[model samples]
Target chain A: MKRWIPVVLVYIALIAWLLFSVFPFSTTLLIALKPKNAFMKFPPDYFSMKLTFENFKIVLSDKNWIKYYTDTIIIATLSAALSVLVGSLAAYSFARYEFRSKEFLMVFILALQMIPAASVIIPIYSMFATMNLLDTFLILILVDSVSSIPLIIWLMRGYFSTIPKELEEAAFIDGCSGMKAFWAVTFPLAAPGIAASAIYAFVRAFNDYIMARTLAGDRVVTYTVGLTMFTNQYEGVDLTLVSAAAFTALIPILIMFAIFHKHFIIGLTGGALKD
Target chain B: MKKRKWIPILLIVPALALLIFVMMFPLGWAFVTGLKSMTLLDLMTGGGRFTGLKNYFKIFRDRLFYNSLRNSLIFVSISVIGQVFFGFLIALALKNKFVRFKSFFRGIFLLPWIASSVIVGYSWIYILDANLGFLPTLASVSPFLQMLGLNRKDWLTNPSIVIYVMSVINIWKGMPFSMLMQSAGLQSIPDTLYEAARVDGAGAWQRLTKITIPLMTPFILINLIMTTMITFNVYDVILVMTSGGPNHASEVLSLYVYNTGFTMGELGYASALSIILLLVNLLVTILYFMILRYRERRLA
Candidate 1:
């Protein structure tokens, strides 16, 4: 009985948490299917009468959404790729090299992570405006890639450090150059870490709004910014339209998680645990 | 081996170059901008004169600056505390041996962390809308409470309650990260310690107090620091829900800096405010590291 009591409590607590976390999403889903008038009903219509595709149809038909989705995908993919490429090299360096200021550089990179983008958004905006790079996908990709470099470097460094030095030494002795040896031997071993970092970089770039809003303005709006338009116009707060948009925005992430669930979990937990 | 020494440096150059261009350059530019007299036109056109410390002085004189700082501190403290405590409790409960379906529960609990902040803000807005919301429904269900004359309040619009509402939303969004961290920490603790305490006839409460809390200190501290830093820097939710309106009651330091620079066109003064925020974050990070080092030494 004593042992079972704690078990029951834990189950109860978990159920409560699940309800809290999932209720809003389910509510949004329900509201999306409801008729326009059903949104504000006092008794709260749990189910929709004559399920309508109007909200989804309207959201999909919007001209700007295609551009927004395209821009988001482009930025997220390019940033993730760039972050992984640069971060892998830097991580390899940190793993193998015994240089002066190595620890300092690593800590400096960590400190850089602490600097909020909001604190620097103005300066970045001004800089981009001068350079005429505002509203360019290049700016979004560049900012996200740099912001994600530290974690990628750290995670890759952790993964690379665990690989035996003997493998690299053997490859070098067998006539492979240092770079070639790393590419052939160490890179494959660290693929999981690289994959993890890529997902993170992609997600960060995909989900980021502050930087996107500041840098791109309306010209290169991401899906997040596109979603914001639903609210800013404020025509009686179309719950159904907003819900459909929210769900649309969430689908890609959910799909990514589904496809790369193992890598995502490994990457996130691995990075946190190592820290 | 000798040739290989520079290879790492060569490999690291791209990342370093990108960082310097994106992060370091803007950081230096911000400081320089803060030291200059720059209008929005001047900033946009790259034609501004240096006027040292004047913006800093003006920022100090601004009443909104101090109010933002105070509100930020209060919001961060309360939200961080709530998140960490609840997260720890939930983690502890989940870590118990008898807990069933742990992975399913954890995944569900983690939904908030992954959900977009904009969506969470919007959902809460729907939930708290005074005219038509679930809370009003719940309130109406209890006639005794309705008879007690409790008026429904528009939580987001009220200045006094806006900060608290924001804090609740922040906590809801943030607690999952802390929960994951605490659960990970719990995994590292050895089961034998708990078993030995049980064998000693120690009650369940004693076993938990003696074995669990001390072991979880590092994770708790880490979560505290991270959450505090994050809460202080929060913006997306505030921007979505309130936009620092109703007399700017929910204006945090970061948001204040944003509004000053972008909305009001006070570029120089905004830069000063940004610097102040940087200093505060630096202080918090230093304090955390100091405590961590002290604890490490004592443990060693």
Candidate 2:
């Protein structure tokens, strides 16, 4: 009985935390489900059963909404692929080589991760503006990929370190060049890290608000920026529609997270403190 | 290890070049811009006069600067403490022997962290808005909630407590990272130590104090500094939720920098403000490292 008491208490606490975690999302969902004018009622009838798919249908059918999705997906995919390709090369070098300033370079890269997006927003905006690169896909891809590289390098480096160097050495002895040996021997072993880093970069780019908002405009509107457009259009009156749009934007990310959460956790934790 | 002396450099060149072009160069440019008296018009006309140290001096005297500094301090401290505390609690609870379906619970906890800030912000606004909010609506019919002071409508507007409210929401979003970190830390601690403690007649509380906290200190410290640095720069959620409204109640330093540059078109001053933000980040980082090293030396 004594043991059961504490166990039950713990379960209650867990359930409470679960409720707290889920409330905002579930409520947002409820708001999204309500009929167009239903939410405008005095005090807003949150428990109303007058739910409809009209909001989701409307948001999904919009042409601009579709464009935002495509833009976000394109930018995110390109940045992910670019960061992983670049970061893995750096990571491999850090993993396999003993070079001068190696420690300094490693620390420098890690410190780069600490640079906040807000700090460089102005300068980056100006630099790209000067190049006539503002609102271009290339600029967003490059900037987003650059932001993710330092962490990806750290993550992929950790993975590369775990693989045996002897495999590459043996490949070298078997008449393979250094680059070929790497691709043939060490690269496949580091696939998990690459996937993690790619997904990390993808999610970072996809979820990016400030960078995309400041740098990109009508030509390169991301879903996040697009959602802001919905809010602006409705002026907070048709929140049901806005909620619907917001929920729609969340779906892809939530789905991705549900599928790759383990990788996400590993990448987040690994990139932070592990040497 | 003998291949070619330049092989590693060759491999690293792409990433290095990207970093230099995208990050380091902009950082240096930001410094230069901060040294000038530039506006958006000046940026177009290419006519910013050199005003070395003038913007920095202006920042020191600006009332908004001091207000934002105070707000950032409160926001970061509350967020860091709340996140670490709740994260530690949840991680500890989940680590208990009776916990089941651990991965499922963890996945749910991570949902908030993964969602875009725009989604988070709008969802929260609807949930907390004074007139149309779910809580205030719920509070209307429930006397119990009224007794608990949950009836207040200005959760996001009131100048005095808006920063605190934002801090709480931030803690909600960020605790998962800390939980993951603390979970990794907990796993690093072997189970045999607990067995040994039990054999020595140590109760749960004693074991926690002696074994868990002391062992978890380094992880906690790292979590603290990381969350601090992150929270200091996390203006996105605030930007989406309030935009530092109702007389600049929740204008954090980073948000202030952004507003100065973008909204007010004071590019040079904003760059200067950002430099100050960077300095604050560096200061916190150095302070934490000193504490970490001091702990390590004592242990040695």
Candidate 3:
């Protein structure tokens, strides 16, 4: 009972923290599930309000929303694939080579991770505009891939460095060429890292509002951008529709995070702070 | 071995070139474009003339730019403090051996982090609204709160507290990442160190301050730097939540640049502003690399 005291205290604290953490999510979810006409009341009046799934139904029913959803899925998938492909190629070179200017290159790539998308959005838009690529899905994809690559490559390098050189050495001895040895032996070993980075890239791209809205605009509205349409035409925000649409935009990534929190957390910390 | 020197170069060149084309080229172009007078209409036709430091001078003279830079600094400082403090507490609590279902708690705590900034801003708009909102509703019911003036938080509208409110929101959103980082740091501290401290008759507070904290400095530094950078560049939440309204009370540098470039059609001026921000980011990154180098040397 004496030892149990501290454990019980820990549980109490944990529960209190969790309630605070869960408040926004639960309230938002409650609002989303509420009937369209039901106004938010003090005490929340859950029993009195007519609860319904109509908001979610409305969100899904619109073809515009479907296009937004499809656009996000396409962009996220392709960008994740691109980040992994580009990241792995560079990461492998960094891991395997003892080349000149390696340290300089490493630092340069790592520094690229901190370039906030806002800073580059102007030039990126201008460059793409010059090529008549603005508002296209391709531009969003390119921007997303570039933004995701720096971190992915760094994480991939960390993963590659962990696998012993002897595996590739053994492959080489078995008559495999350098590229073949890497593909046959080393690449498969880095699959978890690849998956983690891909998920990270996907989440970043999917959740993006600034880049998606700025570059793609009305031509390729992502879910994040589409959901913004719920705003008041004049005041520029509508809580009722926003609650529904925000909930819709949130589910896929939330589910993904719930399932892969371990990989996500590890990959994030490993790539960032670990030397 | 000498012949294979170019092999690595070949392998990396495509990726490096792609990155430069997509990432660095835009930055360089933005810098060059900053020297020119460009707008949305002239974007494709190349109609803007070279104006040297005219755009830069204009941004420097702008009051909004100064306010934004100041706001960014304040927001970053406030957020860095709040996130680090709350995050360290959460991490310490979670690190307790008595704490059960650690991962479950971690997942719950990460709700703010997992949600997109837009979703976060959207949710907060309702939560902090003067009417039909949580805080105001709570204030209405609580007599003590009403007596103490503890309720009715004007989270988005009030210029005085808007930036602080934004800081708190980011602190909540950013705390989870720092918590995880702190946990990693805690785990890396060998148990033997704690056992030795215990043998020497150290109390819980002493152990925390003397052993746990000192050992966790690197992680703490990382968290501080990362959260600072992230908070400084906050645009989406502010854009969606307040649009930097209430007389531009909460406009950060990113929002200023974004509005200027995208909305105001002052691309050249926006580029100059962003370039300033970019230089800040680069300077900080260099400092971080130096710190990392020093830490590595000490550890080795």
| Best TM-score among the predictions, by candidate number | 2
lDDT of 2 at B128: 93
Backbone clash pairs for candidate 2 read none
Q: Candidate 1: list runs displaced more than 4 Å.
A: A40-50, B137-151
Tens digit per residue, CA lDDT, model 2, B184-221: 89989999999999999998889999999999989998
Model 1 chain A TM-score equals 0.90
Candidate 3 clashes between residue pairs 3 or more apart in a chain or in different chains = A232-A237
lDDT per residue, candidate 1, B108-196, as tens digits?
A: 67666777777777777767667655555556676875777544647788898898888887787788778878878988989888888
Off by over 4 Å in 2: A271-275, B1-3
Candidate 2 lDDT tens digits, A1-275: 46677677777877777888888999899998998787667867787688899999999999998999999999999999999999999999999899988898888887777778789889999888888899999999999999899988988998999999888889999999977988898888888788789889999999999999999967999999999998898885788888888888888888888887767876777654232
lDDT, candidate 1, A90-142, per-residue tens: 88889988887788878877878788787788888888888989998899999
DockQ for all models: 0.60, 0.71, 0.58
Tell me the lDDT of model 1 at A45: 56
Model 3 lDDT tens row, B109-145:
9888878878888788767877656667767778997
Interface RMSD of 2: 1.5
